[model samples]
Target: MSDVTPDQLPALPVTFRPGRTRTVLLAAGTALFLVITLIALLLEHLSPGERISFVFTAALLAGVLFLLARPKVVADEAGVTVVNIVSRRRLEWAEILQVHLRPGDPWVFLDLSDGTSMPALGIQPGIAKRQAIADARTLRALAEERSTAGPGAARG
Candidate 1:
């Protein structure tokens, strides 16, 4: 993804998700699970119950990977939805006070009207730093355009 300038915002209902990180995690997890399951099924030395247990354990590990791959930010006309590892939060345009992605931070954060900050793991600056910065600016622009109440209403 390229940098999104304030002058040319993308269409509404845009989604921001980590590009490489999510894919890598999901793929690795699936491969590992499959290898483990194959081993369990092919190893005749292990009892039937043991095979079941092994598959079950693999499934649990995959579930955890799915959790890690779950985070994303969806921005629509009305508001934005932030989905993290274990939580999902919805905020109206006005409810988002600001969007921040300072250096050294893991991901984008929304400073909410409630005085609490919420992490947006979807826009992480790990392997894709430029994309994440661009996404952060795009989200900030959206918030500012949606809720221009007063000064500092949508600072990035």
Candidate 2:
């Protein structure tokens, strides 16, 4: 068990979260739920099974949309952490070899020194191209700074 409280957590200097993307997704989900519910209500003779199915479908859709809207990436002097729709990853700055956000790519990817890449879905091109690029650059800068500072400097 850890002794530190939430308030004692190290502050992340940079955090990227779904901006317009989250808003749009939430709005769309709400609109979809309303439309479906209205339609189902209008059908006065809906069978019990049909009603249950529609409710289940709406709930599932909402859950998926919520997950999709919650992606985020946080970076500090120590490292970067990415939380996506279905996964999360934490990487020390020394482990990140590069940050890639090329044209045509959907999101930023961190090339790790271990020869693997991790996608940073929070910095998605679809959110805002310029903002996404800026976030990627900021993450890259953090990685570079920490890498040059030598191992464990951030921890100290």
Candidate 3:
């Protein structure tokens, strides 16, 4: 398939915008946290001895909400990029080994050549119809291209 020029294959469509569910949850959480923090601050004004504890708790909660709501995916010609909320690692296409479309899996995954795996940017099959199938096909084609480009092409 390496011989098949890039132009021959349909361009890889960018799948998955940042997780909307997570984004919404993050927004809600932030709003709640802010309200709570403001209440805590007002209480602190009345009770100075307890202010430090309330402030610390509010800061911690805000931090967690920020991490959870952070942008997770951005796709372009270079490849898909993923950012996990807590650990915040970014992965690129060159790191991917294979893409699988399994019945039970909620989203597509990039099986790394090193035996590790990362979830695809936003290719969730559970949500749509034609789009999901088309995305899966695109991913499979990309995987085939990578395999053919790898060392095993001669044996096959």
Candidate 4:
């Protein structure tokens, strides 16, 4: 195992997101929406209600794609903010007991002090395995470095 101890962590106010996935989803959603809209407009035989339904369907799909791309993790001086699909949570450094990305896991998981594990979807390994590993290491290092020395300190 490589030492996650970095020579230097990035400056504060750093943000990590699934860059490749986000880009691909956004582009695909936009393209799909446009294609559907164009077809709705060009199909002269369709009833007005059917055309409206097509556009609405396109909009709904695009919205779903946007939600899927919303997960991100932001670390600043205060703490870490984990934004998952349809939910958001802020945590103090000590709140995170450990960060793990086991083999075959979909994304990073934070074992919180409250005894609940929360998925950190921002650092997923779907299409960016290497990047996710590096990111998970960085986050682990940060949690260890920033957590105050106490009962809840993120020490192994």
Residue by residue across 1-156, what tens digits does model 1's lDDT show? 214545698888899999799998899889879999999999989999999999999999988998999899999989999999999988899898888999999999889888889999999998999999989988987887778574344244
lDDT of 4 at 141: 79
Worst 10 residues of 3 by lDDT: 147-156
Give the Å shift of residue 151 in candidate 1: 8.5
**Order the candidates by TM-score, highest first — what do you get?**
4, 1, 2, 3
- Between candidates 3 and 4, name the one with more favorable TM-score: 4
With candidate 1 superimposed using the best TM-score fit, by how many Å does residue 80's alpha carbon deviate from the native? 0.2
C-alpha lDDT of all candidate models, in order: 0.88, 0.76, 0.58, 0.87
Model 3: pairs clashing at backbone N, Cα or C within 3 Å = 16-122
Q: Which stretches of candidate 4 lie over 4 Å from their true place?
A: 150-156
- TM-score for each of the candidates: 0.92, 0.80, 0.58, 0.93
Local accuracy of candidate 2 as per-residue lDDT tens digits, 37-120: 777767889987887778778878877888889899988767778899899888777788777888999998888778888888
RMSD values, in order shown = 2.9, 7.8, 5.5, 2.3
- In TM-score terms, which candidate is top? 4
Name the regions of candidate 3 deviating beyond 4 angstroms: 1-15, 44-46, 88-94, 101-107, 120-156
Name the 10 consecutive residues with the lowest summed lDDT in model 2: 1-10
